[model samples]
Target: MKRWKIAGLFAMALMVSAAPFQAFATSPEFAYTAEKWASLRDNKLEYGEIADLIHEYNTTVRQNELDYQEYKGKTSTDIAEEYYDSANEVSERIRYPDDDSANYANQIASALNSEISVTNLTEQGDSNVDDGEIKRLGYEQQEKNLVQQAQKLMISYYSGKASLATLEDAVTQAETAYTQAQTRKAAGMALQSDLDTAAEAVTNAKASLQSAKSSLEQTKQQLIIMMGWNYNDSVEIGSLPDVDTSVVSKINVTSDIQTAIANNYSVKITERRLANSQSENNRATYTNTLANQKETVSTNVKNAYNSLVLAKDSYDQAKTSYDLAEKERAAAELRLSAGTITKKTYEKQESACLSAKTSMETAKLSFLTAQVTYDWAVAGLASVS
Candidate 1:
């Protein structure tokens, strides 16, 4: 019965020691699997899906998530418990020692003392730092940054497409102008210098168009790759949702600053460290660090809010300009119908209208970006030092 009880205790100790390692092996927090990536390849990437996509596809963020999981799985307490359990098992065996009884007892005593020392050290370390929580917060911060980057890439890709449309129109207009200039010069109605200038404009416009096309392609490639697609893979990028400028009116800067300070990962980590600081010097240093981080978060949130306001103003101005451009283009169409404006002049007005439309689209995207930045700031992922 004694032997059976000892064996049972030893078995239970082994199981207890292995439990954390088993959990660590099975825990897959933020794990990115190949199947997940394969499934995403066929889906159209939208702005709203950027955060999830980044969490799965971004190498750095995925690695950080894994690191956090590993840290949490192998916590100091878990390790200390495992050591203590091992020492208990060895001490239990010492109770039924035979010819090497003294040897077994010495080993048991040594193991228990070592386990105690290890437990003390681990407890002291845990008291000084919340490593698991800090790592988890770090991973969260990284994911937020990657999400912002992916969003910016999406905005750039669409904005480039808009600019590409305007450039293509400009190229067509320039070519038509060059042909008309050539015709007028042949009839001696236009100066040779005028024809030369028109030819130069056509060359410049075509070069600009080509450059814009290349730039747009590069942006598309970046966005697709970030979305976990091969660089050569074909995927349709959906258009961004229309910006709602009214959100600016709902922003409360002072309230947002407080929220940012509370949510900010850096500020929170510093606070944790400050709480764990045992020495007066270390506590004071962390206190000052905490204050600086809070201040930085406050400033970042305020700046993001201000930027959103500016973006709103710019969008409003661009909308007004676009409205005016549309009216002028309408009048120019009538003038063309009445034979008062040449076809080239009317086309120039149309190009101007297209340019205005592109400006408005770009401004709207800028406002959206600012809105995202501000929202992220208030949520505790402010971009600051």
Candidate 2:
């Protein structure tokens, strides 16, 4: 989102600060939705304040990479060091007689299992090689997924705000129209039926406004839960920021699937299980399951990508329709003002424009959700072993 747009949003919140809002509490914390949304999106954004957590994560990842690199470098430059005591075990097994050889083999096996000897000293032998990487990736992906969740929630929050605002305006308009209709009817210029219809419009608009408010509150709770905050906090969300679609272009289906196969947590877990399993049947089962998992991961990525593409297409179509409706709405407003069209006709055109915009936003939300999910599945914790 542009800085100016964000500034404008805050400005709007400041404008509405004086309004009497009856929420669940009386505290004047973020009475406007824009203020709360901006806090969640920026100031109090999840993981932002927890620099220690991110620092720990980076430290761990860096150390693991260094360890892996050290292991690789040692293998390349110091073949003698690599083969030392671990390679001696193979010779020791053959050098011993039957009984001694068997006992020594058992001892060596126990040592290797316990990580107490030089038998399993390579990077492949170290459990931390996979474990460390997986943990770090999981943490990084979790933060990303949360942000994606926040983005969708933010969009919905703004949608709810718009609906509520629109309905509130409608209620006021309907009430004024109703009062005018009643006055005109008394003067014999308008019928009782006209007054009744205007009164009903007011009732309907008020009901819609209430419904919109309720929806907004529900979403607020969702955002609160996501940020690990108290639900009763003053959480008036700000305007929805635009999603960065540049990430989408970076996603490669083939490369991502390969990455998932090599790194996915489930795949890595299953691989570890297969490696550690003593039974031939159990190993075969885990291997088959892992194979199936690879296929599933591939399918999920493909499906999510497809969904995003379809959503973008849908948004394009919706936006085109909205643009045309906006033009119609403008003409309707002019016609109504000129007394060439009825107020109802003007309202219908206005509603068409609003509905079209809502549809476009809905499509945009779907695309972003799919984009986030796909990114997680292919590159993040979902993909790491």
Off by over 4 Å in 2: 1-151, 165-205, 236-240, 244-251, 336-339, 342-344, 381-385
- Candidate 2 lands at a TM-score of 0.55
TM-score of 1: 0.74
Off by over 4 Å in 1: 1-41, 73-130, 188-197
Summing lDDT over every window of 10 consecutive residues in candidate 1, give the lowest-scoring window. Answer: 20-29
Candidate 2, 1-385: lDDT as tens digits: 4322433453454345433212111223354366544543442434232222122222232233333332332322144344454545644543323555658877666545545334454432432223333333444444555555555675567657656545766787788789889899999999878988998999999888888888888987776555444556664454444665556667677887787667566676666666655557767888898888888877777777787777767767877887888898998999999999998778767867777777666666666666656766765345322
Clashes of each: 0, 12
Query: Relative to the unseen true structure, what is the C-alpha lDDT of residue 69 in candidate 1, on a scale of 0 to 100?
Result: 48
For all predicted structures, in order, the TM-scores are 0.74, 0.55
After the best TM-score superposition of candidate 2, give how far the Cα of residue 19 lies from its true spot, in angstroms. 51
Report how far off residue 372 is in candidate 2 (Å). 1.8
Overall lDDT per candidate, in order of appearance:
0.74, 0.58
